[model samples]
Target: MTSTATSVIPSTSEWTPGDVEQAKEAREKLDIWPLDEYNCKLLNEVHPRNYVTNADEKEGSLVYDLIAIGAGAGGLVSSKQSARRGAKSAMITERLAGGDCLNVGCVPSKALIRSARAVSQVRRAAEFGVIVSGEVKVDFEAVMARLRRLRATIAPADGHPGTEEAGTHVYQGRGRLTGPNTVEVNGKTLKFKKCVLAMGGRPNIPSSIEGLMDAPFTTNENLFNLQVLPPRMVILGAGVVALEMAQSFALLGSQVTVVNRSSKLFESKQGDDEAAIILQNQLEKDGVTFLSSSTVQKVETINPGDGDKKLPLMKVTISDKVLECECLLVAAGRAANVENCGLEAANVDYELGKGVKVNDYAQSVSNPSVYAVGDCCAGVPRLTHMSGEMAKLVVQNSLANDQWKLSSLVVPAVAYTEPEYATVGIASEEQAKKQGVECDVYKASLEHNDRAILESSNIGFVKILVKKDTDEILGATIVAERAGEMINEVSLAMKNNLGLYAIGRNIHSYPTTGEAVMGCGVQYINKHLPRLD
Candidate 1:
């Protein structure tokens, strides 16, 4: 609730009307919303109001070899890559430098999830024959504080200082495309030979839901600012963020309900219905209630005179039921942050829901000198690592004249819920069938794994789809503890065209959870390969 201006910059300059407006603009650029010590420290690192760049001094003479808009993972990587390669690169963003993943999406959420996991682990210690003597308690404030502290600790690497140190000029302002080769930011015009649109996405708050805009609901962007855990919480949408947060809060002692429009969870993407069911069952076991085929009809917030001192109780009316809670989180979906960046001026083709149109090379279809990456690119997977990969691709193609492709890259994704759901390439057998590929599914149930059985954490499976009669890995879906880490082995295999035969040949250590991944390969080998006995 504090103002960033006082702590971020001491206002040594005269407070003229224009100066006040500039200060406001700077605050809006980062949009941290919560001006707490941690957020302010983050602002000081990423978008300090007092920080001035070469663009402000030599606007006309400062023509960069490459100018990347948006300082998220993609922007930072793209501009830094170019800069490191001896290109005069400059990056402009209307928000914090580290982008969504570092600031809100991945970093804070994972920290909070880790805290939640600790709580769950302590509660379930007796199941593992390690009984605790006392009551398990969660300090919600400390959890949030830890998230902020970690975020601020990790900020310097992607902040303006780090970016500039990497040899890319950093500008904190709304970057608008003035021409194919020019970008305008805070009255500073930066000319560039190549432009990269890495302006990430925002949470999609559906306007169709009545009273939702008026209610004090939280999105991923500002969810970390909570001072206390809600006793009762209602989450909208059954996507990755919704399910992840629902389970986390439930583990932390919130009566949580997840409302989704689909008849089942994870029906939209990741096509692994069986794997989705396993994850949903695990979440339900963790005290999360699911309302499938439901939509929020209305939302109402009751302040009870506490104002900013307390979180208002939210009355969310959904299909066939009315729910009340201290917290309402909207995780419906995400929309690209493609507005107000002057895409038209740059002749960039973009859609409101989708993002900037680009070819397989990540170059703009209409303007070859212009490119797009990360969540800002239409139809690309919205993952932090994918953004980084695309950013690297943009740098290679823009600078080195390489034709490294976006389609060629196999992207992996994971929902950091307990028994994490991880998938890559083709997600399920159904998806492979839909694409008319002849496939066979090989599954290794974790209940049979020695490591999982010993840990009393055997509740999921590792399922892989391969081309029929061959070892070609089409896709994989893993639902297990450390599934996120285990899925990388499959991703590497798919990326290199290595088949199940290769995976079967590799030696996995005895009685490990990763044996399940290797077990899938063994199953494929046993069924397909002939024995020379």
Candidate 2:
């Protein structure tokens, strides 16, 4: 295997002793471990050193059958599937192998949300016919600590050790395409017969707002690391992430204000206006403020000065009014991490703002040997579960002679708020109407559900759309406490060509939120049946 000596940065004239120690610790963390029994066992049939060696050693020879670029859910799944099929595989990553889902996005956010939910439940204990204590206080520090601990426990499953255990070589470095069949990571170049890019994405910070970069702000990347809750927080972009955190933080004792350019909160395409209004009303009741059709014109930091130790405050100008807060969060959107990956050098067609161009099989349109998935790919839904589905398709297409495509997959998406919102298949009723297809929409409010009423969490509804004459299930939207979990049944029905009649005929256990789906189906069937004279 090839090895290179680590270079030490020349000491600056104004360097401090603490800086030196920090650098030393960082270097120690980056040290490569020698292959031992554990490493050997993890690597299994493949030698680990082969992946770290110079490209010359494997030149003209395929080092692996499949090489996944990013070690997120998509890349990890691709590698594991390839290895299970007896194809040599390796995964290269720039950051933690688990990518954002394990590190920053899903795992951490959900942990915080769970903690926030506990607080909300305790505060509303009286509503459930239970007596409460003197006051419900949120220990913000302890809450954050619990989130960190949980993340650490779940991290190893997506770390280097986990990837190695899955029989894939793990390379920790920025992987760039040097050739059509070759990737360069760290100082080593590896050749592969097939490659999949799953490099994921990052939070998109808008550049239109002046002084936004200079001001103290947080994104999903560092938001979970906050130890103490800010007294007041201003969030830009009333998207899924912003709304979720706004409610969470406000419930956790922060005065939260959401400012958005659009008059409506959620997007019109995937989200229902009625659902958005309900969610907005719920959030407002919980002490969160919304500034709709507003833009942050400028941000100015106010310092106490005079050697004051207080945290600086921010004065934000939104439209004609000014809002001051201690913290600002930018949840505008996500941008694909397609740059600096040598896509141009490899002739992979991609666009700025948009991601890599791919075909039905997840294969790059420009280079058939290479494929892209997850947020890095263009035109695919930017959801973790969707990425996993794309990964499976890429693996099947790569390993087997017969290729499977992603076109037929029924994907479900969820936004994890207090009353979660989930949708599957075609969610828009208006779009169905615009297409000239006669469809029926059936809805059931959670207020009528036994489980929701018992739990005092009756806040949302379930709406299902189906073909008018045939009773075929077309799309569904569930807005409730466990909408994320409840939407799966609808997705399954659509996948298997099940109709509303089947759902209505099936028995749903009494006193559960899931019964709402069955209730919607029953309503549809009752409405469509021949009228009694």
Candidate 3:
């Protein structure tokens, strides 16, 4: 697992006078920290002088209390928590510190989604009795500019300075495990008592598609880099990223088409078909075309020949049909960054397509001294919050004596679509039945919700599954405008082992989306009430 190529970090010695002035101007314009040559050198240094003590004084060994690989949410949290508890911690990262969530995944996508939602709301302003106005248009450049501005502003918090300020030694290089407790970075060996791997994941590209490798395309990593919106966009895959981007781009005036090999949009195991249909229908209404049970056989980029300024077009083949678009976005899935990281050298068990093998406690099964979290951990949910939760558990297990196991049941997942879908605990009723658990289901439609009625957004429902003859809430799902925010209440209930009765007894704010959760709970409780004489 040795790295064939070493990471190269920009140095201050290479910067010219113009480079510094340009960086200063960009920083002032975006209100972001200047990534000048000095800052770049500082962030990319292999080891800072202040942190690494003389190895000769300590018997020729540079030992740290904890070592965290990857600077994403999990690694950041692990290092911070360890340092806060008086442990000498070190974190190593080869790329940007925040990983996918801040750089390419959550933050940028949400920013674009918010801009798209604004366009939708403006288009529907007539429903709110607003006066007649001119046609609404999306300033694509402005939207992207704002996204860049926001990302730059938030970047410093996850940069080297932020982690160093938290009392953790920050190392900027690719970290490879030279031994079970030794990490080698930039020709320097860092021995640690405990280590946590949070290398995260990258967008998975399908190699089977003909000409796809040579075709110009955008994944989540570079989607926000677009300065001008494509007139037509073809997206591969119908998972969360594809669907979310499809809706957003369609709303922002792109003629978007989504191609999927499966007949269904979301995976059947984790997603409800009914909920998928509801979201699909909404996206279709917004001018997004979906080709289910279809796959992209090949792609060819051709010059439109309209003018010099015309962007190149992508010709995609799906079965007997051919679709052309200005851009192609591959959102099939994600691959864990487990390669060339010395997992084999460390004797950590890992699968090729999957990730590092770990138990419920996130500890490496083959090596007790090592732990893996986030997208790099096989069988764990690859969500930002889930990574943060695993970080806490890793910190507890690494530093404290407490041995806490990671629980997937209490973790909630949300797809941030227009009418968001959220679920927690055991979502599949058949799985519960297979486990010999009898469940009672209670449902409430958003159509009956007062807030939904007022907003004319009564298109989803809240469903709760309770153990039959008991108040135990096995699972809950919410489909509404604010499902992401509403699902937290159910997650909190599950975490505290509270029953549906407790949720029902609790009062929610009037005329709010949260009432739907309370209503489902009340429905369950009332359905089981005993008959009186």
Best by TM-score: 1
> Global CA lDDT of candidate 2, please?
0.78
Candidate number achieving the greatest lDDT relative to the actual structure? 1
**Weakest 10 consecutive residues of candidate 2 by summed lDDT:** 1-10
Q: After superposition, how far is residue 394 of candidate 1 from its true place, in Å?
A: 0.7
Where model 1 places Cα greater than 4 Å from the true spot, the runs are 1-36, 55-60, 304-308, 531-533
TM-score, one value per model: 0.93, 0.88, 0.89
Q: Please, what are the lDDT tens digits per residue for candidate 2 over residues 1-533?
A: 11221122212122122344433432243221112232222222222222342212334333778999998889989987787677777788766556778767898799998998898888888887889879899998788767766766776667555556556666657899998888998877788889999999988988888888887777887677565678899999888889889999999999999997888866645467788898999899888999998899998878532111244588999999998887789999888989999888788999776799998899999998899999999898888988889999999888784578878889988889989989887676775776777887889999878999887789899999888777788888889999999999898889999888888888998878999999988987787789879
Backbone clash pairs for candidate 1 read none
Q: What is the lDDT for 338 in model 3?
A: 94
lDDT of 3: 0.80
Deviation (Å) of 501 in candidate 3: 0.6
Worst 10-residue stretch by lDDT in candidate 3?
A: 1-10
Worst 10 residues of 1 by lDDT: 1-10
Please, what are the lDDT tens digits per residue for candidate 3 over residues 113-155?
9999998998888899985589888898788767766776777
lDDT of 1 by residue, 1-533 (tens): 11111112222222222244644553455445345567667777776765566333433446877889989889999988898888878888777788889888899999999999998899888887898989998988888888988998999889776777677777777899998888898897778889999999999999988899988888998787677788899999998999899999999999999998998877887368887888888899999999988889999877532323387887899987999998889998899989988889989899897999999999999999999998989989988998999999999999889999998999889988989999988888778877888888889999889999998789899998888888899889999899999999999999999998789879999889999999988887788767789
Ranking by lDDT: 1, 3, 2
